[model samples]
Target: MNIRLNLVATTSLVALLSVSAASAQTMEELIEGAKAEGMLTTIALPHDWCGYGDIIASFKAKYPFLTVNELNPDAGSADELEAIRANKDNKGPQAPDVIDIGLSFGPQSKAEGLVQPYKVSVWDEIPDAVKDADGYYYGAYYGVMSFAVNTDLVDNVPTEWEDLLKPEYAGQVALAGDPRASNQAILGVLSAGMARGAAAGTASGEAGLQFFKELNAAGNFVPVIAKAGTLAQGTTPIMVMWDYNALAARDTLAGNPPVEVTVPTKGTLAGVYVQAISAYAPHPNAAKLWMEHIFSDEGQNGYVKGYCHTARFNTMVAQGKVPQDLLDALPPAEPYEKAYFPTVEEQDANKNAVVSGWDSVVGANVQ
Candidate 1:
């Protein structure tokens, strides 16, 4: 992910101009506007174990008047982008009211003018690095990239990026598809690069490309898989996965071959799940309402049940909501604090180069 401070200033200016042109309304007024419109909010999100269902349930409970429809494409970011691109011409019901996409794709969506801006009141609680300046997108939750090791397969678990390249672990390690293929997998490579002293945010940097090339040459690369259960059950000794998936897998692998998840001692990349309103949403009022509700205290707390990290730092700390044990399980937050999210310009300039690099260095090995 790329982070550019200038984009935030640009977005803020646009939002200020937008508000100046329209009459400002309070939160209650916005809710009333939403109710009067009888609008429906459509969402596009992944069907993975990222806690989308939990968020949906909360939204339904709060605004019974507003209708919420979801379309689970179960496709990669590129596929989702294509769907959004196709809808631009049709302007059909398939057009989303809101989109919950991976962080890496947030810039592409913003750059294409497919996203609308609406900053919530609690926006200040979120770090600037994880959010868009114009309110086009806000990260709802995040997962740190980490290694899941099957204790039964190897006596010693790898604690750093360099450890994965050991001769003994050759052909034993597995990664998510190329970063270009999956946002999470891309962060996995970027995190390893960061540990090697690469410049932050830019994906085409030497550290990132070289690190991926080595992982590929080691025969550790794996394409996206529908079922990771077998791997968690020891079918594969080691795999790169997000914190939630790793935790879920470990919970599932309780009896048989126990699995352990570690945020590498060297460092790890954190991928955020960002939410944005559609540029041409049918229910703008309801879409804004949905954003307000999700960032509210009640909604953010629900993530704790699924072991997902909420984006609002102050709220989490104020509620005393985070469990002590889970806090212990978390890697130090400093790295995440300094984490990056790409800007529209950086993404536009480097996306092709980065994708092509991954294709040559990593995708070639996967095939």
Candidate 2:
């Protein structure tokens, strides 16, 4: 009977491993596999931006054994794609296990075969429009465009698009990027496109460029990308930037005067940044674990703490997966209810149009 029991135990162990090998169906299995893999690396995630700093901290606190390597905290989205291409076969820190990039980069990445498909446990909670049905990439979080106003320099905080063009705001309105090349700047224009035109917005219409043209003509449009220092120095006191950026400056610039973050009343465009596992990931198990952690309730909450609206927020609320304080921290949800998220195709097209048409519309070089 002892011999029989020993044989049965051996067979059971083999079966459990087989299931685990096929996929990490349970947290216990996922963790076990991740520990074996031992390391994970990421590209272009600035910890301070979008609550990544705290998210990384919490992730480390949870998985002490799993070494998390953050590479190039400031690399752009294009640079991230290049890294995946360069390290397709490497196993060292040079090989990225995961990537978070702009929405426009998704279709291009999938088509180029730079990433593979893997669905997190919270996959169903994510919106279908923002994620691949095959599970390659999913929306991580979205930030609505907002005004980061310097109250010291300006008496009236422009609440709407038309307010930005008023004489009082001349030389005060600044864009975050060059519309010809900057996605951030493009999103600012796109957000303004909505407020300048009808319900659908003018990404494809003539109004977007015209609005900027008028701002430029009025000397209200500052060509340079504005940063916190610029705001503090009063160079670009009123910057058109992401809501998260504006809100984050509150804590980051706590020593300076308060930075007010406001969502425009005439509707605004939202930009979604998606996360994906590298197809050439050297640490495959660790990569999946990282994805699981990011989509997990704890991970989503980390983003909330940073002032970004997580892609799974509504679902988290329904399931009671988020903390109350994090929920309370979010700016009012109604103004953003008017916020529109374009399809990947729509985003790509709009981006192309914005970049190509920027020269004709504004024509001013970023000084």
Candidate 3:
């Protein structure tokens, strides 16, 4: 179960043995170290994003000794990397111990030496395709892109990407984050391109940029970064974001103003977020413990409660670990039938295109 022991990369046998010996420490020892550290700093994790509010409470309840220091909850994936880089020389609270970032940022982070390698106890259970072979980072959870509509403000609900461009939807549509930096927003554009029948990769990215350009020109695109509050207030009637985020927002709003979450049948794109420990973490043990906890059965279920599909979903279902009620609580599976998970390489290419082209192509600065 402890794949990290076998995957240690070292030039000398002594170093390998040293890491193996350290990895052999019991969970109790890890707990003790984490308790001694007494704090774990995390960045870009909003409480509602993946039931992290409850999950963080659960961790606090279980490990009373450690305090979870949360940084900017709304920071984008690029912002997360910048935090690591900006604080590499400082071992203060501003320095994040861990990060939850987009899949495309995983390899880039590792390549830039921003993150350290540490596999959870259930390493083998995680799908190999979404995890680093050396354990620098691994998929945490994922959700499909969807439109969260404020029914009170939008009588004609948009069921498809193109439907949002109609004049009736003017001043209504918005993206969840800044496309120039946000993984979610960038991928949303990719989804729109895919919906337009463009092939995935750079082509789709370019297509998505053009679509947004037209959307901006049509006066249908709101420059505001939409969230639950903005949607409920009718500030942004239609938000393009991950299904999990839309679901969470819908739950939080409790039908006040009412909400409709729809995964466009033509352009459903599944985006995965990954987790990693900062290479210069001030609390390495606590960060590792956090990783272990998130990959655990209870932690994974917490994400399910927030509408996200955890990385170990298949394994948990096969082992009958997830609760039946939680599974039943999810939205209808039909809309996600054609959800597409882009390759890391493809995402990297698409992200480059979107980020570079967004300002000039879209001309809408999403706050």
Residue pairs clashing in model 1 are 2-341, 2-342, 179-186
Q: Please give each candidate's TM-score.
A: 0.78, 0.83, 0.94
Clashes of each: 3, 1, 0
Off by over 4 Å in 3: 1-22
| Candidate 2 positional error at 272, Å | 2.1
Using lDDT, give the best candidate's number: 3
Error of 2 at 203 (Å): 4.0
Q: Rank the candidates by TM-score, best first.
A: 3, 2, 1
List candidate 2 segments past 4 Å from native.
Answer: 1-38, 86-95, 177-182, 198-202, 364-367
lDDT of 3 by residue, 1-367 (tens): 1111111113246434534654576789889999889999999889999899999999889888999999999999999999999999999999999999999999999888888777788888887778987778898888889999999989989999999889999989999999988999999999999999987789889999999999999999999999999999889999999999999999999999799999998877888899988989999888888888999999999999999888778778888998999999988877655677788888999999999999888888789
Residues 19-106, candidate 2: write the lDDT tens digits. 3453445777768878888888988777667899988888888888988899987565667888999988778889898999877778
**Model 3 global lDDT (CA atoms, 0 to 1):** 0.88
lDDT of each: 0.64, 0.76, 0.88
Across 109-166, the per-residue lDDT of candidate 1 in tens digits comes to: 8888787778887878776766777677888877677777888886789888888877
